[model samples]
Target: MLNEEQAIEARATLEELHVEHRDLDLVIDHLLLSPPPDELLVRRLKKRKLLLKDRINQLESALEPDVKA
Candidate 1:
């Protein structure tokens, strides 16, 4: 049960992460377009992107209201 301030902070963090994820997407696309892209660097970036996705999901779930059956 997060307070209003905590919820606001969490939302802000989520927005920041979303922006970073989008930025990473652009970078990955650019990397793919160029010939002889660094395989290792791309792999690392992809891994980081996945981690950000997981964190985003977590925060989203946390922000959702709990449901009771």
Candidate 2:
């Protein structure tokens, strides 16, 4: 089980990651709508989106305390 401080930090980190995810979504939308989309920029945005998803999973896991079977 996480202590109070650890739990608080984890929650804060999760919030920050969620905000980042939203920002990435906006960027992706903009790129998709561009008349002459930059393939390289699109690729980079996709990669970052994947990374943020993984980070979100990790954060959620951290927020969950161990449960005995």
Candidate 3:
């Protein structure tokens, strides 16, 4: 369980990560459009995007309030 302050901070971090992920997506697409795409760079960016997605999922789960069984 997160305190109110911690929750707020986590939400802010989540937002930042989402923005970065979206930006990376755009950059990757643009890079692929250029002739002779850089395979290595694209791979690296994809990996980073995956990591951000994982983190976003984890944070979202954390933010879910517990339900009584």
Candidate 4:
């Protein structure tokens, strides 16, 4: 469970990452459409996007209250 301040920080980070992820998607799409696309760079950007997605999910989970089983 995050305190109020921590939760606020997490939410801000999440929003930032979401914007970045969306930007990466646009870049990737443009790369795909352009002739002679650099496969290596595209792959690297995709990997980074995946990492950001994982981090976003992790933060979202942290913001949620834990349930006792």
The TM-score leader among the candidates is 1
Poorest 10 consecutive residues by lDDT, candidate 2: 59-68
Q: List, residue by residue over 1-69, the lDDT tens digit for candidate 3.
A: 988998999999999999999999999999999989999999999999999999999999889998899
Per-residue C-alpha lDDT of model 2 across residues 1-69, encoded as one tens digit per residue: 678899899889889988998998898889889978888998998899899889989878877877789
Q: Rank the candidates by lDDT, best first.
A: 4, 3, 1, 2
List runs of model 3 lying over 4 Å from the truth. Answer: none
Q: Per-prediction count of colliding residue pairs?
A: 0, 0, 0, 0
Q: What lDDT score belongs to each candidate, Candidate 1 first?
A: 0.93, 0.87, 0.97, 0.98
The better-scoring model by TM-score among 1 and 3 is: 1
Candidate 4's C-alpha lDDT?
0.98
TM-score of each: 0.96, 0.88, 0.95, 0.95
In model 2, the runs with Cα more than 4 Å from the true position are: none
Instruction: Judge candidate 2 at residue 52 and give its lDDT.
Output: 84
Error in Å for residue 47 of model 3: 0.1
**Judged by lDDT relative to the true structure, which candidate is superior, 1 or 4?**
4
Count of clashes in candidate 3: 0
Write down the lDDT that model 1 would get.
Answer: 0.93
